[model samples]
Target chain A: MKGIYFLVILALVTAVDIIVPYFFIGGIASLAACYLFWSALTFAVIVFAIIYTSQWGRRS
Target chain B: MKPLYVWIAMLGWTAIALWIAAAARKKMRPGASEFFIGGRRLRGFVSGMTYAATTYSAFMLVGLVGLTYRLGVGALGFEMTYLIFTVLLLITFGPRFWIVGNWYGHITPPELLAHRYKNQWVAVIAAAISFFMLIPYASAQLMGMGFLVDGITGGSIPFMIGVFIMAGLSGFSALYAGMRSVAWTDAFQAVTMMATSIIALLFTLYHFFGSPAMFAAEAARKTPELLKFTWTPELFIGLSLPWAFFALTNPQVSQRMYIPDSVVSLRRMVIYFSLFGFLYTIISTLFGLEAAIVIPGLENPDKAMPHLLGKVPVMLGVIIFVGIFAAATSTLGSIILTLSSLFARDIAKHFYPEIPENTERWLGRIVILLLLGACIVFAWFQPGLITVISSMASGGLLVMAPAIIAAFFWRRATAAGALVSMGLGGVITAVMYLANIYPLGWWPSVWGGAITLLLFAGVSLVTTPPDDADRFISSVERELVARGFRRH
Candidate 1:
């Protein structure tokens, strides 16, 4: 599930890189894409943190 | 405008930074581990700020502005790639590093590599390459400081002296308090940089265009290419990929993972660092674009920031100068500390096993001073091709990224394979860059990284997996467990 989310986000970003310039979004598309990239990355970090922290707690 | 006030403000900031260093020193022990890694007690916010400040550096502010000014919006691709690369770094490697560093008492990348590969020679060679590559990088920051001071002061102070002052302060910070001082200073610098960037953007946008739409239209009118998001295939594949890889594998950056307090802090750092990197890039690029509209066709694109700030209110110019210095010094301090640690822990410890901890700490300090002196001498030579130096260093480090990734993930990876791939990757990229065989034009990073990754994957597939592969992987798993992260 995590890997799937990563792939979907990456695909969306790549699509933005490809399609946004064709239309007249006027650079906002690039900005939005950058934000989405950051969001996805942040989500991944949170997921890892939750997993790691929970595991640590269990072991103790 | 009173020049004296500007000098006073700069000096005042320097004194505050020094006081913080003094305070940190009093509380900390004087040993290599304590000095270099801050006794491994840094919290999420401090580590995150340090990572962002060091990663962004003066290059992003001055050099990146110039790049955007010349290359237009396509340069944002470099920034985007960096964001992606850093995210990949944290998710895949950060937790592992935090656990391994604490568990094995690893101080440097090569130290960990040495233990994993069971070869001290590998660690020595890796350290040598990393330390030498860092020289040009550190010198570039010094050169940037020199340029910033000269630009702001209008040549009252010699560029060399400016370089010396910034570099000397950075050296002192690293020597006095090590990573602890560097991390605290970075937090302060990061805040100042973000504030200055926001103020500069607000002022530039108001003075030029009242709205986002107006700003885009104006930029389009001045340079239509500025609005375009296209890059040639050569650039997309050749330049972008290498930079992305470098964002992960560069020893300076990878080492940051070693210093975070815990796995949870490491996780928080990833989010904060990505946001910080994204915001900094967008604002800096916008500043460059606005500068393009204000001052058309300046021979040096690097002058965009200074030129734009010069037109702003006098008070803002002083603030911007301070911010630029912050960007440069924060980066320089981290680089100096990393280089010193690499020398002391990786090189000296491997060769001379009997050195006392205090002696090693002194060796690290002396190494910092020597590096500073060497950079000063290098700065005096003043290479005409500053961008080339940056690109070459980036390329060299990109060659090592694949090996690093494989070392972590691929159980089949061997010491010989790692070394061969990196060496060949670096060599091929250098030859191609010098010969200019392709139309790629000034992008060794892509070529080097592609070749390196291919070689690494190929060699790992053909060779027998390391005997300790399962054990190492399990250890990492246990570390995650210890950190409260459960396996899927």
Candidate 2:
């Protein structure tokens, strides 16, 4: 795995995670909206991990 | 809420945990490796469950719930940020740790640093930092247990009794069979934590607000401030920064990257742990919101969950009580086991390189008892800031982050860089925490992390790099591709 790719992706995700919650969702006073956004963000990262590791140990 | 019910439930849980520990000990082989890391033969499920159990603590049901009750949706954001960072770090570093650990037979995280830096002092200092930082975090687990039992039983159980019971159970799991017993019991505890929390959550949703939708609607309507993201930027970053790097910094959980048997098992470990963490974070936060809506106006936010328990049916209250007990005990056991291995493998072996494996193991057992004694004393006073204390531990350990990352990715990184960075950075961060000095309203973690990074890079630029830095990095890189962890 190239370290830079993972680093950039993670940095971007973290930035978005911080900025979106504070800027976009902060004013929305609904639990469902904030809760859904966080759940989706976390779930997306997990899916990315799954896909990223799918190629491991597959070399012939 | 009766002490009798709590006692009976605890007894049944202890019986089951001991039975599992005994079974694990039977299968355990004879060696320091076996004692310290289950001989690195653990399968994916056990590895995943233990990771879940160890990474989480009563901090989830008790501490995090309280944080959410007080702070609102920002609490969920902070926790979810941690989960996101952990999964990313695991995917990036898990295989590297597994490959190096298996090749070098390294039992502790600091040992990995020693090999990379070609200096034993690197390992010793790293281990020392871990020992000093994790004590408060471990004691916070005990205090969580003590407070929960005391709160649920209406103080009939007494705080010290709860503390002693958890410390005793955790101490036994660590001393009995080391990692084998701890991992097995942790797997059991992880299941119990998830299952009980889920059941209680569902019951609360249905009983309190008629359904999940109703619960959400009522939460927004009744406590609109909680639903709104209200945390200040300083507060959010201060709390989330240390926890964000937890998978890479905390020795107790970071050391777990060495346990899975293969690449596939490592993958499974990350996936399982991710799912468990996501679900548990949501459940804990939902309970916090429910408590805010149903049982508002509590003087101490930490008592939110326990107060909510009082409002629930007796059976459900007891079930949630055991869940928090299991969470605290599992986390405490894992920390004790990891610290003992660090003491034995890094410190003891560094002093006496010719020490026999059995002697090292015995020394580890002795350290486990001493660490438990210290934690019990710490818990007895009850800091009452469970979440803050836990975060302080993580922040202190965050000093090691630059050293660890540079070990694999930056060949120019040197021994002086790691030592100066961790040593000085740890001291400054610790002093800041003790003195309650937050420079310019920022947490110590942010300042410590920034200072450590600067020290690591700047010092390495002036100092001599290890002669074998290239060989070490290339060999690991070659193996990564051979093991299919990386593409050519």
Candidate 3:
């Protein structure tokens, strides 16, 4: 599950990098999109780590 | 040209930073962990502020601004690249690092490298490169501070005197308080920096254009070239790629992962720091653009910001001076602290295994003083453009970045591969830089980083991974388990 989440985040970031520049979004929108994508990815990973750890503790 | 109010405010701010350092010393422990990583007690806000302060230095304000002035909006690409790289670092490796460093009691990057490779030589080599490359970068910080003081005071303070004062104060602060001192002072400095940026941006907009429509019209009429954003392909790839790579592999930044209080705090900091990096980069670049527009046809592009400050109102000039001082001193404080840690943990521990911790701490203090003196000598003798020194310093470190990343992630990365790639890449980069080989004009960092990555990847594929690869992986996995994070 964690590995899958990581791959999804990676794909989304890669897609944003490719699409944003190709469309020539050069001003505030480009900056906003980049920040939003990065923050969201980071948040998702943190959530996965936390949930995964709690489940492992319960099993043990 | 103005009253002494600006100088007074600058001095007062320095005093406040010094006081904070002094207060933090009371909490300082004699252990290496306390000295280097603040004993892992730093909260999310303090860690975020320190990370931001250390990352945004005189280099960003002075060197980067000068680049933008010369290259126009295209330089924003370099600044934005780091946002992507830093977030990647935070998500992929940040939690693992915090867990390992805490579980294993690691203090420096080399210590972690030693753990992963089980080779003392690898740790020694990485430490040597970090200390040697970072000193020149620290010297550039001193030079930048000197220039800012000279410009703001209208030559009332000589460059050498300014360098001495700033270096001496920062060295003393780091000597007394260690990372604890540096982190708290960074919080204060970060606030001052943000305030100054807001005021400067507003003032610049008001002077140039009262509204968005007016500003656009003025930008179109007066300096349409600034909006064009045409850069050479070589520069587009070489400069931005190396910068992004550096933010991930730079020892100073990696060391931050060791100090956060918990995985929860680290998670919070990653978000705060990324936002801080984005906002500061845009604000600083806009400030640079305004400076370019106001101070047209300046012979020295680096003087654009200082020259613009000169033409502003007295109060505004004072505020900007405070901002520059905060930027310079915060960076200087971090450098001094990091260098001292490198000397004590990597150098002194290797030579004298039985040295007392208290004695070692004082030794670190003495090394800070020596470094300050050395930087003063360099600042006096080799006073040059901040951009040149920055690029050279960065070029040297770029060679190490690839090896560092591979050491942590790629289980097949050998100690031999790490050594060969870093040494060969550094030598080639230096040779190419000297010979003027690259199309965007031979920058040490660009060539060095590219060669390092290629060589490291090639060497890793041809050679077997380190003998202890499985053990190291399990240890990291175990650390994550202990920290409440499950393995994959």
Candidate 4:
């Protein structure tokens, strides 16, 4: 909800974004699944941030 | 290939865009700042839509599609990383930019920097750097339009014609009502881009492969190499690093931070842009993946989208081409308008204190025309060195990140420090890029960012801080608190 929390989420999402692809170069089926999942996960983090930030905006 | 359909789509789209511009002109006010920043009265939706339109250009559908087609899942990760960083940056600094912009009535981002650091040279140098760096990039957007048209028309229409048409249309968009017209058209174009791309993507999936799952299966079965994440760490970082800080570095989008009418609107701007970016990134990257399955072993990766278009129905292909045109025009128009503001406010008006505001507005319009002309020439010439410049554009801009970030967060930052870091760092990165020298197997952006941050910090620590460093930072903070942003 706050800047620090937002920053933490940013770092986590970015790390996953990089590390997952680097380490999980699996076979075709697994790789397709990984790409979709990782992409969705990264966007979901931003969606959460937007919700939190707007709530914070309203409260402030 | 139904070149006629492409022409018809473009003509119809241009008519609609011009009508929007005419409508925008009716509401326009006088003066350079009003024209450039829409008098800073944009609503949240318009603000968000224009920001999204400007930030996600033809590159998403064309360049990015090609990148994804070539590199695999790494393209998605790289793009998603940019989105994530942008959202976080907006949440953190968007408020600060809005508060300071309101307090000072700043017209351009560089002007804000000059004010914070209390140095005219800062604004001048920053504007000059923007001028030098953004023109070729803008021209490339026009070049993109040319290539798309040329390819779609099968050489019936030449490349220069595409360049001219785009240059003329974008120039008109900027010349009409400045930011107001550009923003209105951008909102329209942004919608067109998403809708057309989505329809095409779904059609590609259902018509060609029966379903999303089927398409994925086919892709996995045939071009599994694309699904596999085989990007080297060096490749990934080089490509993604500059883009991660794009929110702060690229003035076209960064200037949007000053446009929202209220704190709530600014918040909505971030939320809306983030959502649009999220959907659009997925769509573009998926298009890239689909291209791999649909058309394999293309000689040029960048040709993936064009090749895919050839296989689609004529009407759908033309509509998608129009979307790409919309994307490129919206971006080109915004960049021209923003850069004109930079020239008029930070460079021209600074030296000519006696110039009237009305004259300043006219100056900006003239600059818009001249800028478009220059871009058209560059795009038409199609020089060999442009490849290097195009490759270096993001990283070159990345050199400004430390200076901008420090301007808001670090009170000890001096004008000299900001200037040196941006100037030296930009040159160093550009030289290394041009010389084909990547130290340590890392990208220029990584090296540029590291050096810029260190230089900014080291220089600021030894130099004299701006006399009002504490006042500027605290007052902005106080304003942020008043606007509802929490402070620890």
Candidate 5:
């Protein structure tokens, strides 16, 4: 169940990561804000990956 | 861009790499296992470095930078999607592969599939697909060197000489002590690659625009289109989907699961590779974005990196050249070494069961020489389609993903299922890519993967599985718990 739950979250995050940047805030005229939003999303994914996998090998 | 500087950088980089290979020969023990996989005893750091070096190639610095230059923020999304999916997939499958590999003493990725399927043909088929797909990919690395040197020196070094120089060094690095030398040199080159690129990036940022903030502002002001996210969903999925499964589909990286010394080492390999990949992706993509601002109006987007180097200080430019060379050479060396192991263990030994281990080891070395020769010919006569071929390499290899995942997870998977899916799906995918045939705006990888999943599942249901499937699954399950992983 935990494994399935983790995979679900991974799938959702991946969908959001790909979908949002290209559709929602990507075409805005404000370059700095748009770039920052995209950059922040990428950093969030990286941080989440680090945190998620850090506990992958730990005893549950 | 002088002949002298190009020669100095190329020669100096080769000498240092060869010296590292020679030094690694002293630490390696006698035997094929030691030669092929460092006796399966590599510590976390070395294992991690080799993984990082093997996975991230010259493609990142040259091809990826070009993509980002031509495309925009969408390039970052495509690349980052790969990283995110790879890290997630690694967390899920890394332990499974490690435990199974350690338990069975599997020497190659194909061997694991062969063992699980209890069929020699599975290994042979997988190796054949890898050899076919990766050679063009490897040739692209050499072509990268040729392009870099030729562009830097204005053709004074000659493209052939540049290709041969990198080929000779790459061949030596792999042939010296096999994986031991390759891993050690890769670690060295990996560090060299990152450090030099970081320095170059900072130099460009500070020297040109005064700071990263300034660089971004200038880029946004100058070429606002390059800062926008404009990649179509089809284009994004087309490029990213294959790489999303890269950690599983590409044997050069998948085989690393068998090299780490323990579960802890395996963990470190994943963590270190993730962080390294994270930082490197940022650097490479940022360099691409910066290149657009500083050196705009280039006719060929692929020449962006070379043009950027031409604009920087000569000393820094020379250092950057060596760094890009290190990137290509490390990639070529690792690919050659891994392919040699695949040929030796999976294809050759499977055909000749009575062949001695000593003969098998020699066979691997011999294959390295031949593979390098093939790659040189391919690179020298460099096809104009190198980029297309390289892009399609991972996409074609995606045909293997369904089969690979089914190995550990799907008990109903049969040898016949794996064979037909990989062989037929790989053929269809390659053909579709080459013919520029996209079905309804979908990439060949998307089509191939969909077809492969259907074939794998459909064929697996009707075909009889090997009798050992239950035992194989149960053993891995039991070992996962024993290795401190909870199933739930």
Candidate 6:
């Protein structure tokens, strides 16, 4: 993944992070939904990091 | 609940930390670089652990728990957002900082700014702003210790003693072997922090609600409003904006980007720190929800963790106490060590120019002593808003974000622009924080960030760019491609 691609992905995820919490999760008064959403979001970002950094130090 | 148990636990933990520091000292080499940045040869795991420990402080178990208890699911969102931004920033800036630091022999983040801007005053001013801003942040760490001891022991042990003990141990670790001792002890502390917090969290869940699923059900039913996202957009954005940029703006953690041994190790540092942050954030926030459900109506939200500890078994309570202590001490040690390096290298050595490497190291040691003294005094007062104070410090440091980003990406960024933006923006933000003035119900960080970006870009556009700016950017980009950090 290139830098621009990573930035684009992050921007989209961040928007989801903010919007989902306020708009969707706000109406659900259950801890399960909120916890699941954040955990899944954080896990996804970490996956992206792993993919992006796989070739960081390798010579092409 | 007993003062004796608290003292015994603390003493044992400090002894182990000192032994680790002693071992690290045996491996230490003599020089300014060795003292400040571990000769830039730190292994990946150590690099990652120290980064995690330094970045996530006592604030996690203490301040974050309280925020979660009072506010609700927004706390998790705020913290997770910080983690995501931090991981993204590290992946982006880590290689750049590592390569530039190695090529230029830069010992501190401000020194990198100085070299890129080609102006010593820029580094000096940045270091000064760091000193002015970070003291409160460090004090928040100490304040966490004080509150932990005071709350858990039921005020049997005075707050000042807790404050003094943490300050002394952290100072000793930093002064003994500089980055070597600090980083090694930090690895130990990081492990202790995670283990103890996880054990305590699980026990709390089981002891109170019988299972994780039950705990979630109980929390949702008992405090449904907290499960709902309730923070205002202004509050959420204001609090998170500075922290979102923390990896770039906070000099303590940013300086770690210079210490990895290789590109592979740098990669491990980012990945490990991310995983660690992810787990720790979830645990800390969960503990907050538990506190709200189990013990509600506490006047001071910051007391939630300590109060929860009081309800747990004695052994578990002491274990968690040591964990919070370890967390605070490691963070304080790292901050003190980084700030001292900034003072010695950017401020002291810049003006003197003739100070020997050994003398520079000694100067840093002296500054560590002075810095710890300042933090202890600040913590003595026992600040009320630990989370807010920590955020304000980052907000103040946010003024440098533009200059920092521009250094690697924009050739037109001028030294004068960096100076004007950082200096003016820092002062204005600090004043707003001091004067308690938030214009239009927004945060100083928000306004300060916008103004700083404008100042940096506007000034750089009109001023003469540095002659070496183009060469610096092109060479760094070429090196990035050579190292396979860039695909094309």
What TM-score, computed on C-alpha atoms, does each candidate reach? 0.89, 0.99, 0.88, 0.96, 0.96, 0.99
Q: Given candidate 2, what's the lDDT at residue A29? A: 79
lDDT of 2 by residue, B4-89 (tens): 99999988899899889989999988999999999999999999999999999999999999999998998999999999999989
Poorest stretch of ten by lDDT in candidate 2 chain B = B145-154
- Per residue, candidate 1 scores C-alpha lDDT tens digits across B364-412 of 8999999898888887786644555666667767777766766666677
Q: Can you give the DockQ of every candidate in the order shown?
A: 0.23, 0.79, 0.15, 0.49, 0.42, 0.68
Q: Write the per-residue lDDT of candidate 6 for residues B261-340, one digit (tens) a residue.
A: 99999999999999999999999999999999989999999999999999999999998999999999999999999999
User: Which residue pairs come into collision in candidate 3?
Assistant: none
Query: lDDT values of the candidates?
Result: 0.73, 0.92, 0.71, 0.83, 0.83, 0.92
At residue A50, what lDDT does model 2 achieve? 86
Ordered from best to worst DockQ, the candidate numbers read 2, 6, 4, 5, 1, 3
Weakest 10 consecutive residues, lDDT, candidate 5 chain B?
A: B382-391
Quality of model 4 by C-alpha lDDT = 0.83
Give the lDDT of residue B282 in candidate 1.
80
Error of 4 at B180 (Å): 0.3
Q: Which regions in candidate 2 have their CA more than 4 angstroms from the true location?
A: none
- Top model number, DockQ: 2
Error of 5 at B250 (Å): 0.6
Say which docking band candidate 5 falls in: acceptable
Model 6: lDDT equals 0.92
Q: Model 4, B229-317: lDDT tens per residue?
A: 77778888888888888898888889999998887888889988998998898899888988888888987666688889988988889
B395: Cα error in model 3, Å? 2.6
Chain B structural similarity (TM-score) per candidate: 0.94, 0.99, 0.94, 0.97, 0.98, 0.99
